[model samples]
Target: MIKTKCFFCKKSYTIDYSDSQYQKIKANPKAYYVCKKCNESMQREAQSTTGLDMDVIDKYDKFLR
Candidate 1:
């Protein structure tokens, strides 16, 4: 596991070193990690503010993963 800090919350967390997301972050200096909690909160906020369908957001989120 690799130790890293969350981009939004600045909390420390661990991730698998070989994870694709870690590789992407390694390749891009500008890309920072967001912990799952922060990501979910942001997603919920976006859904509430934009009034977008949950299914649409879910589908897009899954596609990114």
Candidate 2:
């Protein structure tokens, strides 16, 4: 498992995966894994902040959250 800190919440979490899954996630520089609560909270916050549906934002942007 790799320990990662959430860019928004500043909380640390672990990612446990097989070698193939790890490689795939590692290949993507923008890959982020946040805890379930944070993910839900961020989505709601994004919608409220932008005054638009969550679909309008590009979830892949590392800096968006």
Candidate 3:
């Protein structure tokens, strides 16, 4: 297991040695890791502030292309 701390919450946690995230972090020592809880919280906060639904943004992106 790879031991690391969450960048946002500063909580210590472990990542499985075989996980893709672990491999990425291993490749870059300066990479930051966000715990699942902080990641979900940030996603929710961002979505709430955006005011537009994800589907609408996706459709707009397709239309632009």
Which candidate number maximizes TM-score? 3
- Report lDDT (Cα) of residue 28, candidate 1: 69
The parts of candidate 1 lying over 4 Å away from their true place are 17-20, 28-30, 57-65
Q: What does candidate 1's lDDT look like per residue over 1-65, in tens digits?
A: 66778898999877776554687666664578888788889978988899996777466757654
Clashing pairs in 2: none
Query: In model 1, what is the error at residue 28, expressed in angstroms?
Result: 4.1
Off by over 4 Å in 2: 18-25, 28-33, 49-65
Residue 4 lDDT in model 2? 64
**Per-residue lDDT of 1-65 in model 2, one digit per residue for the tens?**
67666666878766667432345456663576566577779878987888877554565654444
On lDDT, the stronger of 1 and 2 is: 1
Ranking by TM-score: 3, 1, 2
Clashing pairs in 1: none
lDDT score for candidate 1 against the true structure: 0.75
lDDT of each: 0.75, 0.63, 0.75
> What is the full ranking by lDDT, best candidate first?
3, 1, 2
Candidate 3 has its poorest 10 consecutive residues by lDDT at: 56-65
Query: Pairing residues by index, what is the TM-score of model 2?
Result: 0.44
Per-residue lDDT tens digits for candidate 3, residues 1-65, read 77888899999888987544687778885789887788768866877998766556676644432
- For candidate 3, what's the RMSD? 6.0
